[model samples]
Target chain A: QQQVKQSPQSLIVQKGGIPIINCAYENTAFDYFPWYQQFPGKGPALLIAIRPDVSEKKEGRFTISFNKSAKQFSLHIMDSQPGDSATYFCAARSGTGNQFYFGTGTSLTVIP
Target chain B: NAGVTQTPKFRILKIGQSMTLQCTQDMNHNYMYWYRQDPGMGLKLIYYSVGAGITDKGEVPNGYNVSRSTTEDFPLRLELAAPSQTSVYFCASSYGNSYEQYFGPGTRLTVT
Candidate 1:
């Protein structure tokens, strides 16, 4: 079963526009939510993460908005750039904080 | 520091063949992980180790084996290659269970 479900398998946006990717989970035991970004032929790198204790977290142009009651989280890239084009993954950590469940992936493209 | 490094950037295996994917980290992390990423599918954990001499299976550990002999090395072994096993393998490490993970570029393997 898919523990984390992500929407909009692919996305296209203009430069400077905000591109958002959403993900939802059913397991309340998950406490840590992280976003990873992967460029072609490269490994997925940690983008930003949010714990259930907080409703939002931001780093640079990336922001993660989380809703604990809904068990949903989203990534918003402000001023999206072509260089930001890549595959994004949202993941949730098990209660033990050792194992993680990842969403399928979202390919985002920023057209200049 | 070379956070994480994986050997054999690309490889092709024939049915019934066997091979080992090498991984090394210079971060001296206590936690290491092996994951497989298929097209559009997010990363799936194959195996992980909390520390040297301690290892455990993850979501999809079948058809794969792993060992963490040193804090720097975590190798993944595949016996009897199958088409379904074709995917990009990634190695990651973190200081602790709650710390952010650093991922290697990845190893693209094709099993025919």
Candidate 2:
């Protein structure tokens, strides 16, 4: 039960719209959850993360809403622009392990 | 500082050929990891290192090897390249057990 399943393999949103991507994990032992953003040919970068204790976190136009009871977390981009188009990955890790389990990833397209 | 750096951003190998993918971190992170990303598969951990002289295999470690002689360097070796080994390799580093990780640009290898 070490999998993190992400939904909507791909998504398309108009400019200035709000785009949301969801992820659910099967392992409740996972205490740390993080989201990463990757461009076409670049490495994934740490976008924002939330701990089990926090229900939500906001950084700029990016926000992460986490639910411990539901074993789910989501990333929301407010006023998404064309530049925001990229692949997003959700990951989880247990408190005792150095390994991070990643989701299949979602390809997002923000059209102008 | 170059958080995490990988060499030979791209490579092509013939069957049975061997090569080493070099990784280094200037942040002096205690944790270093190697991951492979395939289309729609997200990132799969191949190996990880907690500190100098310490290394361990991850989910997919077959046909691969790793060495951690220094805290700043963690290299992955492919003794015999195969078609299945063709994927984008990424190196990441973290200061502690925290979920936040810094990733390199990634090295794309194609085995034919």
Candidate 3:
């Protein structure tokens, strides 16, 4: 079973537009959610992360909105630029274990 | 701090070949993980180590073995490589309390 499912396998948006990617998980024990951005030929880097205790978090142009009751979460990029084009992955991990489950990944493109 | 680093930026091996991917972290993080990324697919966990002597298999660990003999080094070994093992491998490290994971540049491996 896929523990975390992400939507919109790919997306394209004009500069300054908001693009959103979403994910959902089935495991209730998951307490931490994180988003990663990866450029071609490069490894993924952490963009932002949120704990289930918070409803939302923002860092620069990246924001993560989480819904614990719905077992869902979404990532929003505000005022996106071409530099924001990359693959995005949403991941969840249980607080008790060191293992993390990752989504398939969303390829995002921002055109100027 | 060099955060995390991986060796052999790229490699190509024939079927039944064996190789080892090396990973090291300058940061004294308590948790380390190895992942493989394929095109259109997200990152798949291969193995993880919580400490120098504690290691466990993740979602996809077949044909792969790992050893964490020191806090700074974690190496992944492929016993008998196959075409199905062709993918980019990444190493990540994080603190026990911190949810953020730092990733290495990645090693692209192709098994022919």
Candidate 4:
């Protein structure tokens, strides 16, 4: 099993449009969820994250909507701009802290 | 703070060659990790260290080795480089197991 699965391997959105990426996990033991954004020639950076106990988290134009009962989570980018075009990944960690599982990743393109 | 730093931004290795990818973090994080990112696949953990002198294998540790001699440095070694091992490597560190990880700029390696 993938452990964590992300949908829309690729996405395209116009400037000022909203781009949403969804992810699901099969492991209920997972308690922490994180999203990473990576640009060409660089490493991934933490965009946003959420815990199983929370329903949503918003940081600037980025938001994370989490549903523990459904074992799913999604990232929403409001006012998507060309600068937001990059590869995004969703990852999960079980228990307190050992290793984490990652999704396949989604490549997003924002057109001007 | 320099966050996390990785050396050898790019390298090309011949089959059977050995090389070391160096990583250092100024954050003094207790948790350090080495990950490899392939084209379509997401980042895969190669090895991790919870503290100095302690290291553990991750999902894809087959051809790699790691050492954590101090709280700030975690180096990954490739004993025998292979074409299959060609990919981008990332180093990350977290203050604790429950905190967000900070990543390095990443090292791109190509084995031929």
Q: Which number leads on DockQ? A: 2
lDDT of model 2, residue B91: 97
Docking class of 2: high
Residue-by-residue lDDT tens digits, candidate 3, A1-112: 6789998899999999999999999898887899999998878889999998999999999999998899899999999999999999999987666888889999999999
Error of 4 at B102 (Å): 0.6
Candidate 2 runs further than 4 Å off: none
The TM-score between candidate 4 and the true structure equals 0.97
Per-residue lDDT of candidate 1, residues B1-112 (tens digit): 8789999999999999999999999988999999999877789989999999999999999999998889999999999999999999999998889648899999999999
Candidates' DockQ values?
0.76, 0.85, 0.75, 0.75
Instruction: Please tell me which model should have the higher DockQ, number 2 or number 4.
Output: 2
User: Model 2 over residues B13-56: C-alpha lDDT tens digits?
Assistant: 99999999999999989999999999989999999999999999
Q: What interface RMSD, in Å and to 1 decimal, does model 1 have?
A: 1.0
Runs in model 4 deviating more than 4 A are none
Q: By lDDT, is 3 or 4 better?
A: 4
Each model's C-alpha lDDT?
0.93, 0.94, 0.92, 0.93
Residue-wise lDDT of candidate 1 within A3-105, one digit each (tens)?
A: 9999889999999999999999999999899999999999988999999889999999999999999989999999999999999999998898678889999
What are the TM-scores, per candidate, against the unseen true structure?
A: 0.98, 0.97, 0.97, 0.97
Give TM-scores of chain A for all candidates. Answer: 0.98, 0.96, 0.97, 0.97
Q: Give one digit per residue, the lDDT tens place, for model 3 in B21-90.
A: 9999999998999999887678888999999999999989999999999999999999989999999999
Q: Once model 3 is optimally superposed onto the true structure by TM-score, how far is the C-alpha of residue A101 displaced, in angstroms? A: 0.8
- The numbered model that scores best in lDDT is 2
Error of 2 at A92 (Å): 0.2
- Of candidates 3 and 1, the better by TM-score: 1
